[model samples]
Target: MSRREFTQAIDFRHGRVDMTHGGGGRAMAHLIEALFVKHFDNALLREQNDGAAFALPPGTGRMVMATDSHVVSPLFFPGGDIGCLSVHGTVNDVAMAGGQPLYLAAAFIIEEGFPLADLERIVVSMARAAREAGVPIVTGDTKVVEQGKGDGVFITTTGIGVAAPGIELSGDRARPGDAILLSGSLGDHGVAIMSARENLALDSDLVSDTAALHRLTAAMLECAPGLRCLRDPTRGGLASVLNEFADQSECGMHLREEAIPVKPQVAAACEILGLDPLYVANEGKLVAICPPEDAERLLACMRAHPQGRDAAIIGEVTADPNHFVQMSTRFGGVRMVDWLTGEQLPRIC
Candidate 1:
C-alpha cells in the first residue's frame, strides 16, 4: 500500500508502538512506509520486494559478507547509539577482510511500548550513517514483541562487500617478525558506555569511538598491499584480538607497554573501575599486521587518515610454539597478556 493512501500519519510526537503495528496489516504497512521507507529511501528499498537485487560491477573480485547484532543497554549513548553502531559494526567486519562495503540489510526488534519518536530517531541515524559510509540499506525487517519480553530495541545489520583481486587478509596470515600496528587509543567506547550506564561524572567528556573503517582499510591496502591481517577489537578488546592472531598464526606477539596508546581519561576510568584498558572494548580502533619492511609505509598511510591519527607500531610478531601474547611493561619487566578469562563488561557491543 502507498503511504498516500493512509488517512492519518503516525503520531511521532505522542504515540507508542503496539502489537497491531507488527500485525502484518494496514497498520504495519503504514508504519513501514511512513517511517522506515521515508528515512532509508533508495531505489532498491523502494521496490518493496521480499529481497533486494542488483548487479555488481565487472572486475569486482570476491564477495565478502558480514553480520552483527546490537543489543546495547540504554539504546542511546554518547558518540553513538545502537542505530549507527549496528551499521559500523558490520561494515568494519567486512572491511577487516580488505573489502569495500557495498550494501547493508537491517532487522529491527522493537518492544510494544517503544516510543515512535525514539524509533524514528534511530532510523534516521542509521540512514545517515549508511550514507556517510557510501553504503545503502537495501532491505530490512521489523518485528514487535511484548513490552516486558523485549528490550527497548535491538538491531541486527548485515553487510555485503567486494574485495579487489590479489587482496587477501586473514588472522592466520601473520608471520614471525611482522610488525603490529594499532589505529588509535583504546577503551573509549567501553568507558563511555560505562559512564553513561552508571551515571558517573567524569572530569573529561568521553564518547564511543564507533565509526565505519572501510575507507581506512582501502587506504592501507593501497599503501601496503602486503598486509597480513586486520581485526577490530570489540567486546574482548585489544587483548582478545592479539590472542586470536597469535593462536591462529601459531606465533607470539610481543607488545611494548609504552607504545600502546590510551587516553588519560580512559586510563583513569579503567584504574578506578579495576579494569585494564587492554581488556576494555573499542569500536573504532583496529589492529593491523604487516611485514616489518612495509610497517613504516602502512603506519604513514594510517596516520594520514583522520580515523587513524594516533596510529602506532605497538608490537611485533614472534615465533612461539605456545602461541602466547606477551607485553613488556614500562617497569622493565615482561608480563603475559593472556586471553580475557571472564566478562569484564557485558552487552558492551
Candidate 2:
C-alpha cells in the first residue's frame, strides 16, 4: 500500500493491537505516528530521534532524574488511569528532590488484542498530563506481548529535572526538632483504588488524588529554600515515609494522629476495610521536613498552593539512639507507628 493509503487504512476505532504492531515495521510506525506521536508532539519528539536532546539553563545546578513503573490492575480508575498516573508518579519523584521537572520519556508494554480505542484514550490522557505538568514527553518506546502473557497495558516513565543551587533534600535531612509537614490529606489514592476495585459504597464520593506535584513543590521551595527533606508517599504510604526518615536520619519521629488529615470518605472506607489510613498510598500528597522555626511558614506556603490546601504539621523529629516512628493518639496516648508488615492494598499507584 502507498504511504497515504497505509495511514488512512488504520481503523482506530475498531482495530486491535496485534504482533505486527511490535514488529518495528510499517505497522509499528503507523501506530506510533497515528497515536503516540500525534498526541505527544513536542519539537524534540518530532525529530524522531532515538533520544531527546535539550539544553539546560546555564546555571540550573544539579540534574535530577526519576523513573517509575505503573502496572495498576484496572487501566481506568476513579479520577485517573495508568497513563496520567505514570506521568504524575515520575514527575513527583523528580520534584521530591526539590527540582523543576523538565522532560519525560515513556515506554509501554501492551498486550496483543488490546483495543485501539482504549489505547488511544490512554495515550491522550498521558499527553494531557504531560502538557498540563509543562513537561513534554520527548521520547518513548512501545512493545507488544502475547495476549495471555501480559496485562492489557503497563507503562514506565522517566523524568528529568534540574534542582536549584544550594537546595538539598533527602530522607536523611530530618534533624532533631525538625517539623514533619504533610501536604494535604492521606489515603485518597489508595482508598480510591480499593473502592473502585471492591465496589465499596462510600458515604461521600471519593476519587484518586493522582496529580503532578512539581508546581506545589516549587511553591514550597520558594518559601522554604532550606527545606530539609521531601517525600511523596506513594506505594507504602505516609507511615512508610515517616519510617524512612527515622531510619535514614537516625532520629525518632513524633506524629500527632489528630493532625494528620484523612478525608471523611477515605477514613470511612479504610475503617470498613480494616485498613489504617497511615499505611495507605497517596499519589499527590507529600511529606516534608523542615526546621521547627520554618514549620508555620512552610505550612502557610503549602496551603497557598492548590495541591496543598490541606497541608498540616503532623509531627516533629527527635534525637534518639534507636530510630522509631511514634504517634500521639487523639486519646492522649502514644504508640509506635511501625512499618506495614504486609500489603494492605496491592497494585495501587
Candidate 3:
C-alpha cells in the first residue's frame, strides 16, 4: 500500500482499533514499525529474539530475575498507567534483592477494539520509563484478542539484574535486634488507583507513587552492606511483607506506630474506603532490615536520597520463635500486626 493509502486507511486519531492490528498482516506490521519500534528501538530490540541474551558484567556474582504482570484496571490511573508501572514494578522487585537491574522484557496483551491513540500513549510511556531507568526493553511480544476476551491492555514484564560479590540477603535473614526501615509513606499507589477507578472524589494532588527504586537500593546497600532483607511493599502491603519475613526467619517483630510513615491524604482515603493503610499496596516504597548497628547509618543514607527521604526505623526483629509481628500503638497499647487475610482492593496493579 502507498504511504498515503496506508495513512488514510488507518485512523490515527479517532480510529476504532480492531483485531487485524495483531493478525500479522500489513496493519499489524505497520503498527509495530510505526509506534512500538520507533520509541523502544535499540541494538538489542532491533534483533527481535524470543528473549534477550548478553554477557554478564565483570564481578557479577548473583544473578536475579523477577517477572511481574500488570493488569491494572482503567489501564490508566492516577500518577501512572500500566506501561510505566510495569517497568518500575519489575525494577523494584529485582532491586529489593540488592541487585542492579540490567535488562527488561515486556509482552503486551491488547484488546481488539482498543484505541490506537491510547496504545501509542502507553507504549511511549514505557519507552520513556525504560530509558530513564537505564534499563532497555531488550525483547517483547504483542498479542491481540477479541474485544470481550481482554481488558484494554495487560503487560507482563521480566527484569534481570546482578548482585555484587559476597553480598547475601533473604527473607530468612532477619534476626532478633535487627532494625526494620521503611522507604517512605504507604498506600499511595493503591488508594490512587481505587479513587481513579471508582471516579471517587479526590484532590488532583493525590497520585500513585510509581518510581524505580534501584538507585535508592544501591545507596542503602552502600551504607549498610549488612542489610539483612529488602522488599518493596507491593500487592500484600507492609503487614504481609513483614509477616513473611517473620515466618521465614523464625523471628518476631516489634514496630513503633508513630514511626511508620503514611501520608495524611492516603490515610484519609483508606479510612473512607474502609481499608487499613497497612494492608494497602505501595509501588515506590520498600522495607529494609539491617543489623541494629547499621540502622542509623542506613537511615542517614536513605534520607540523603530523594526517593527515600521519608525513610524511618519503624520496627525491630523480636526473639519469639513463634514469629508474630507486634506493634506499639500510638495510644500506648501493644497490638498484633498480623498477616493480611483479605484483599484490600482488587485490580490495584
Candidate 4:
C-alpha cells in the first residue's frame, strides 16, 4: 500500500499492536508516524534518518555518555512512569559525571497486543521530560515481541552530554575528610513503587522522586569547582552509594543516621514493609563528596535549588584499611552498611 493509504488505514483509536508493527513494513511506518513522531517531533528526529547528525560548538568541553534500561513493572506510577524514568535515569547518569546533558536516543521493546493509548501516553511523557531537561530525543528504534515473550513495554534511553572544563567527578576522587552530602530524602522512589505495587494503604503524598539533576549539579559546580565526587543513589539507595565510594576511593565512610534525611511518611512506610530506608531506592537524590572546608558553601548552594532544598551533610570520608561503610545510629551505636546482598526490589528502575 502507498504511504498515504497506510496512514489512513491505521485504526489507532481501537487497534492493539501485533507482530506486524515490528515487521519493518507499512504497519511499522504507520505506527512511527502516527504515534512516535507525532509526540516526539524534533528536528533531529524529523530527519527520519537511521541516526542523528549534528556539530558541536567549539570549546563545548569533554563529551560524556550514559545509557539505562527501564523495566519497572506497572507502566504508570504515582509520580512517574516507565517513560519519564527512562529519560531521568540516563540524564542523571550523565549529569553525575558533572556534565550538561545534550541529546537523547531511545529504543522501545513492546509486547504484542499492547494498547495504542498507553503507548501514546508513554511517548508523550518521554517527550515532555526531554523537553523540560532541554534534551531532545534525536533518534530511536522500536520493536514488538510475541505476546507472552515480553512485558507491556520496556524502554532504554541513551544520553550524551558535555562536561565543563576543570570539572572532574568520579567515585575514586573522594579523600579522607571529604564531607558526604545527600541531595534530599531517601527511599522516596522505592517506597512509592512498593506502595503502588503491593496496594499498600499509605499517605496520598507519597510519590516517586524521579527527576533530572543536571541543573542542581551545575549549581553545585559553580559553588564548589573542586567537587570531589558525585553519584545518584538509585538502585540500592544511600547504603549502596556509600559502599561504592568507599571501594573506589579505598576509604571508609562514616554516616550519621540523624543527619540523613528521610520523610516521616517514607520512614513509616519502610517500617511497615520491614525495609531499611538506606537499602531502598531513590532517583532524584544524589550523594556528593567535597572537601570539608567546601562542604558548608556547597551545602548552601544545594539548598538554594528546588531539588536540593532538603540537602544535608550526612557523613564524611575516613581513612580505613578495609574501606568499609559504617553509620552511627541515633541511639549512640554504629553498624556496617555493607553492599546489598540480594535484590531488595527488582526491576525498580
Ten residues in sequence with the least summed lDDT for candidate 1: 195-204
Task: Give lDDT tens digits, candidate 2, residues 3-66.
Answer: 4336366677999999999999989988888889889988999888889989998899899999
- For residue 322, what is the lDDT in candidate 3? 78
Models, CA RMSD each: 1.2, 1.8, 2.3, 1.7
lDDT digits (tens) for residues 1-349 of candidate 3: 2242355445667775688777877887677667777788888877656677799999999999999999998788889999999999999999998899999999888888888889888999999999999999888878899989998999999999999987788999998999999999999999888888756766546899999999999888888888999999998899999999999999999999999888999888877878889989999999999999999999999999999999999999999977999999999999998988867678889
How many steric overlaps does candidate 2 have? Answer: 0
The alpha-carbon lDDT assigned to residue 206 of candidate 2 equals: 85
Candidate models: Cα lDDT each = 0.93, 0.91, 0.89, 0.91
For model 2, what is the error of residue 340's alpha carbon versus the real structure, in angstroms, after optimal superposition?
1.2
Q: How much is 268 displaced in model 2, in angstroms? A: 0.7
Q: Which 10 successive residues of model 2 have the least lDDT summed?
A: 1-10
Model 1 per-residue lDDT at 58: 83
Pairs with steric clashes in candidate 4: none
| Candidate that scores best on lDDT | 1
Steric overlap count per candidate = 0, 0, 0, 0
User: For candidate 4, what is the total of clashing residue pairs?
Assistant: 0
Q: Which pairs clash inside model 1?
A: none
